[model samples]
Target chain A: MSLLSLRDQLRSGSVTPSGLLDDLAGKIVSRDPEIGAYLSHDLAAAKAEAASVDLSLPLGGIPIAIKDNMNVLGQPCTCGSKFLSENYTSPYDATVIRKLRAAGAIPFGRLNMDEFAMGSATENSALQITRNPHDLDRIPGGSSGGSAAAVASGTAFAALGSDTGGSIRQPASHCGIVGLKPSYGRVSRFGLVAFASSLDQIGPMTQTVEDAALLLGAIAGYDPQDSTSLDRPVPDYLATLNDGVKGLKIGLPKEYFGDGIDPGVRELVMAAANKLAAAGAELVEISLPHTEYAVATYYVIAPAEASSNLSRFDGIRYGHRAANPADLLDLYRRSREEGFGPEVKRRIILGTYVLSSGYHDAYYTKAQKVRTLIRRDFETAFETVDAVLSPVAPSTARKLGESAHDPLREYLSDIFTLAANLAGNCAISVPCGKVGQLPVGVQILGPHFGEAKLLQIAKAVEG
Target chain B: MSKPHIDVRYVANLARLELNEAEVAEFQGQLDAILGYVETISLLDVSGIEPTAYPSPVFDRMRDDEPHESLPLAAVLQNAPDQAQNQIRVPKVVADA
Candidate 1:
């Protein structure tokens, strides 16, 4: 059953909260070993809470798995790296975790992700490679692979994921689920381990658009903890979600639907766009001329921020410390080298060089100027269209280890969805149709803080 | 494979990461490709445009500087790899210097 139906069952006394947990637990026991969705689950604490949870709360008794980056007090917040896994107990609840608990949802388990949310595939996880639930040999789209996998496989009703450069949406596309990357400051980032401070946003991965709305409603808000968080009201996302997309002009960016896109995935996305147009929405062609520069800008900006942010893990205060360093410099170097994965090291190096004195203007500063252009492209497109539609990625889930040989190939897959992060706009990935055994997702983008209209259009596609 | 453009050893040193010979060679190749791709941004005419450090308009959001209760020292220290006398213990920098 979907989250709403499950909610109805809980309220109607058709099934008790404990009974629901048992069913979810049974699924976890049966499926999690194969899927590798969870890093750790607190069944004892979850069952204990199920007994006394306040059913009056909006998300009462709903099980929500968390991507490992967000701190949930005592729960492990391993950003899928050996450093955080070996050290760092969350000292406090992230603002979203506090909100989820208040809304009566169980923040049940820690799902695996790319190390510090860096890679597109969960293979970057120091612990395990999360498999796509649909086909075990394929990768669950990542850095939030486990979050998408958990929800896709029914171990959790929904999950929370952080998107920097399509970390949430691409995984959702690969897993064939609903993933929303809320506007850049739509949700608090206090406890989310910083990947790219400017580009990261916490969002939902769910079975349906309505569930995404419910999950977003529970967590989205302004928080003083995250200085970048906008001081804006989060609307009741469900209020207009079911209203449908009648008369809404959905723009299809020509850049996204190009010859480079896999023909099978393009057909599915265009078919879904046709479905929305048939349902009273107008489909229009829009130009985002700066689209080609988005990936380059994101690579520079995200890594620059990451290099600055990750400098905090210096082995003294928190995370893994090197054993018997010859000196402080040696400690910092050895600890970071031992702690981080190869992808992380590569990004840190790239970021450091980009921001270094001689190269800063030529790379980082230049990238930022291009970022303004990319954002302007979205602004121009939104002037003529209510929302923009496109394929979430060029292709469906590739086989495990397919992208391992070449890192650039993996980065290229993010070309379609990376611009939304650059633009700081809200976007969603909804399953449109199937491509063979894998699922293809269609992406819908709205202007900043246009999640209500975004979810509405996503629901029309879901229908 | 094409020749690398930047000194990866210098960048790795700046990043505070120790890279072996093999990792340096691998990263050099990968970084060259990535830098080559991102170099496309330099072709655009952004002469008059301002660089966007933050995507959003809001900046320097300030709260009153007031004293508030902080996390208990024990809780903060829980994750420390090495500790002594309620403080994080690290290698002797002065002695090494």
Candidate 2:
């Protein structure tokens, strides 16, 4: 059930939170063995926790699944990596978890993700790869694959997923659901396990735009703990969500529509745009000229930030420790080598290389400058249009193992979604339609802090 | 394979990760390819453009110097690989002469 509908039932006393948990438990037992969306779920703990939550609150009685990266107190925050998978338990609630609890939502289940939310697909997860529910053999796009799958498979009322580059939206697209990446600072990142510190934002991945809005509202706000969170008031996203795009200008970036997009994918995205146009949204031919550099810029910047952020996982404090190390250095080296998966190690190395002396200017600084250009492209486009629309990914979910082994191939798949993260703009992926039973989403990009208008446009195109 | 641009051994050492010989060779090739792809930024003239370190660029965020309750000591030590006397224990850093 959609979280809103479940919320309605709870409000009317038509159903109890315990009853909803049982229904979700039954669904997971039947479906998750094949989906592999959950890393762990504690029904007893969840029910116990939910018993105290006020039923009159906004998200009261809603059991939202959380991506494994966010620290929900006492829950396993594995981040799909061996480092934390073994014995690490969250010492405190992440800011998001606290806010959700305050709003009376029960955060249930640890959804699987790429190791440290680094990979484009869950294949890089050290624990287990979550498969797409649509086709069991194909990958659910990641690093929010588990969240997307759980929500889509009806196992979750809604789920929270973090978007570093295309993590949330791409996975939601592949799983045929609604995924949102709010403007950087629109949502607090204090509790999210850092992937790319500057690029990562925790957002909602749900089955509908209405649910995304509800989840975003409960979670979006400035937290004193997160210095990057904006100080401005978070407007009610639901207030204008149903407002049709009667005369809003939506841009169609020509660069996105160019070669390399699958014909089937292009047709579906265009059809969705037509729906928006029919609803009085002007589809202007916009040019994000620097769009070509988004993936490359993101790869350099994200990895650079990730390498620095992930350096905290040395053997000393709370993560994996190697046995009988010869010295302190050996302990640090061996523990990381043993704990991190290959993709993670590769990124750390790449990040170290770029940030290393003499190479920093040529790579990291250059990527940041290119990032300015990318942001400028959006700034320029938004001046003329209310929002920008494009395909969420180049294609639908690929069969597992198809691009799993090739890092470059996987990185290239994030082309369409990286610019929003780079620009720190708000964006969402609403399922447009499916291509041969596999789903794709039409991405709607909004100016920074423009989520209210963005969700409004998303609702119009949702049809 | 063509000559690699990055010294994988040096970078891995800097990252404090110990990769075996086969893993090193495999990563060397992949990193070189990734580096080559990321080199596309060179085509654009980024001169005179200020680099963006953070997306929103909010600066000087400070909180009052207020004391608050800290995490319980037991919970803090619970996840430690090795802990003794409420402290995280690690190998000795000083080498005996």
Candidate 3:
């Protein structure tokens, strides 16, 4: 059942919350083996949460899937890596999970993701490979691949996914769902395992725009725990969501529509833009000249932060210790080498080189300066245009193993989406159309704290 | 302009990760390509622009200095790979006599 229909049914007493849990449990047993969407789940716990839920709450009895990176008290937060799986279990709940529980939502399952939310496809998971629901042969884009696949496969009502560089949006595009990457600092990152502290934002992945709005409304607010979390108040995302895009000027940055974009994907995204224009939104051509620099800048910055963040897993205080090590340094080296995958190791080396003493000025500092330029490009464009529209990814979901051999090609795939993270703005992907058997995603970007306008534009494009 | 040649072994040491001969060779080639691509940033003049370490406009957030419950020792050490007497244990950094 759809999330809305389930909510309606539960409220009207036509379908009990236990009935919903039973149905979802059955669906998981049948569909999960094929899709590999969940890393861990407990049906009994879900049923218990369902039984005690207060019906008066906004999200009463709703089952929400959590990405493995977020700590949810007593659950295994493996982060799809063997290293974390070896020793770690979350000792406390993430701020978002607490919010969900307060709103009467059952935090049901831990969804699969790229190991430590690193890869462009779910194939990077050391634990298991998550296949796209639409076509099992193809990938569900990552690092939020399993979250999107779970929602697409009807096993999850809604799921949380983190976006560093299009992890949420690209996967949602691939799986034909709605995914939002709220403005940087819009959501607390307290219990989330940091990938790139500056760029990562946790957002909702759901089957519909309204569900995305509902989930976002529940989680987004000021939290003292996260230093980066915004102090500003969160507006009712559902309130202005239905407000049409009449008279709103949506910009199509010339950089995003150029060569390398699949003709089919471009055609579908352009169709979406045209539909929004037809619904009274004025389409304007805008230039974000620094768009091309986004990927290069992100590669430097994200890894630099990740190197610092991931250094915590040193086999000392917590996580995967090497047995009978000769010395402390040897223990750290061997444990991490055994724990992290190739993609992760590659980024760490690159990050370490960039941040190392002699080269710091040329790489890390220079990239940060260029990042400022990228942010300015968006700020300059948003002056005349209320929101920006672009293709979420260059193409639809590619076949599994296609990106495995070539890492740079995978990084290039995130070209369109990385700038939003660099700029610290709100962006969302909505299923606009399809290319062949694959789904296409149209991205709507708004100024910082512009989620109301962003979701409204997404709703405007959404059928 | 000449492309940068990464010393993969040196970088691996810096990252505190142990890599064998095959891994070093593989990383050297991949890092060269990635760094070559990232070299584009050097072409632009960013002398006047300030670096954005954190994307948000907000800075130096201050909170009330009130005592709050801390994570219990058991909870903090729950994920420890090695534990004894409520403390995490690690290999000795000092050489044994």
Candidate 4:
């Protein structure tokens, strides 16, 4: 059932919370082996929470799937890596998980992801590769691949996925679902295993824009636990969801629509723009001249941040450790070497190299300046346009192992989606149409904390 | 700007990750290519622009200095690879002179 319909049923007492759990449990048993979406799930614990769920609250009786990185008290937060898969368990709830529980939702499963949210595909997971539900041979885009796969396969009603360079939106596009990345600092990052502190934002993946809005509503707010979380009030996303985009101008940045986009994908996105235009929305052609620098800027900044953040997972407390180390340095080296997969190590090396002495001034400092230009580009574009629209990814989901050896190629696939994180704006992926048998999403980028207006246009495009 | 050559062994040591010869050679080649692509940004004239720490404007959130309940020691140490007497155990970092 859809999330809203399930809400209605639970409120009417027509569907018991535990009964919904039982249904999802059965679906997971049947489908999970094929998709490999779940890392682990504690049905007993969910039942315990569901047993006393308050139907009066929003998202009541709903079983929301969690990404592996978010800390939910007592659940295994493996982050799709072998390092934490052995022994680590969350000691406290993440701020988003806390908000979900307060909204009367039962957090259900630990879904698979790219190892420590590092890759463009779930293939980076040391635990398991979560396949795209639409085509089993193709990848569900990562690091939110498991959340996207679970929701796409109907094993999960809705799932929460964090976006750091298109992890959430790209996968949702591949799986024919909706994903939102709230403005940076719009949602609290407390207890989320930090991939890149500045780039990561946890948001929802679901079947519809309304459900995405509903889930975002429950989680977006100020929290003292996260130093970067915004103090602004979260306007009702659902309230403005149905508002048509009349007189609102949407910008199509020329750089994003440039060469290398698959012809079919471009056609679908243009059709979506036409749909918005037909519905009284004005389409504006704008130039974000610095768009080309986004990927390069993101690569330097995200990894530099990730190197610092991931250094916390040394062999000391609450993670995998090498047995019988001769010394402290040996223990730290072996534990991390054995725990982290290749993609993670590559980024760590790159991050460390960029921020290391001699190169720091040229690489890290230069990337940061380019990032400022990227942010200013969006700020300038939004002066005239209410939002920006483009293809969520260059194309639909690619077949598994196609570019496994070329990490740079995979990084390049994130071209359309990386700018939002670099600029710290709200963007969403709502499935617009299909390219061949694969699904494609049209991305809507709004100014920071402009989710109400973004969702308003998303609803129109979703139509 | 000239392409930068990465000292893979030195970088691995700094990152505290142990990599064999095969892994080092492979990653060295790959990292250089990635660095080559990311270096495209160096061509942009950003002389006067300030580097962005975050895309959005945010402040360091402050709270009252009040006592709060902490997680139980058992819960916090439950995932420790080695623990004893409610403390996480690790290899000795210091040596007797």
* TM-score of each prediction: 0.98, 0.98, 0.98, 0.99
C-alpha root-mean-square deviation, each candidate: 1.6, 1.3, 1.1, 0.9
Candidate topping lDDT: 4
**Model 3 regions lying over 4 Å from their true place:** none
CAPRI rating of model 2? high
lDDT of each residue in A1-463, candidate 3, tens digit only? 5566778878999988788778878888999999999999988878877888987687888899999999998889999998898778889999999999998888988999999999989888999999999999999999999999999999999999999999999999999999999999999999999999999999999999999998998899989999889888889888998899999999999999999999999999999999998999999999999988999999999989999999998888777887788888899899999989888899999999999998899999999999999999999999999999999999999999986667888899999899999999999999998888899999999999999989989998996
Model 4 DockQ (Cα-based) = 0.86
- Give candidate 1's TM-score: 0.98
Say which prediction, candidate 1 or candidate 2, comes out ahead on DockQ.
2
Ranked by lDDT, the better of candidates 2 and 4 is 4
Q: How much RMSD separates candidate 2 from the native structure?
A: 1.3
Model 2 TM-score on a 0 to 1 scale: 0.98
How many clashes (backbone N, Cα, C below 3 Å) per candidate?
0, 0, 0, 0
Per-residue lDDT of A239-276 in model 1, one digit per residue for the tens?
99888878999999898888888999999999999999
What is the per-residue lDDT of model 4 for residues A309-368, given as tens digits with 9 covering 90 to 100?
Answer: 899888798788988999999999999889888999999999999999998988999999
Interface RMSD, prediction 3: 1.0
Model 4 reproduces what portion of true contacts? 0.93
Residue pairs in clash, model 2: none
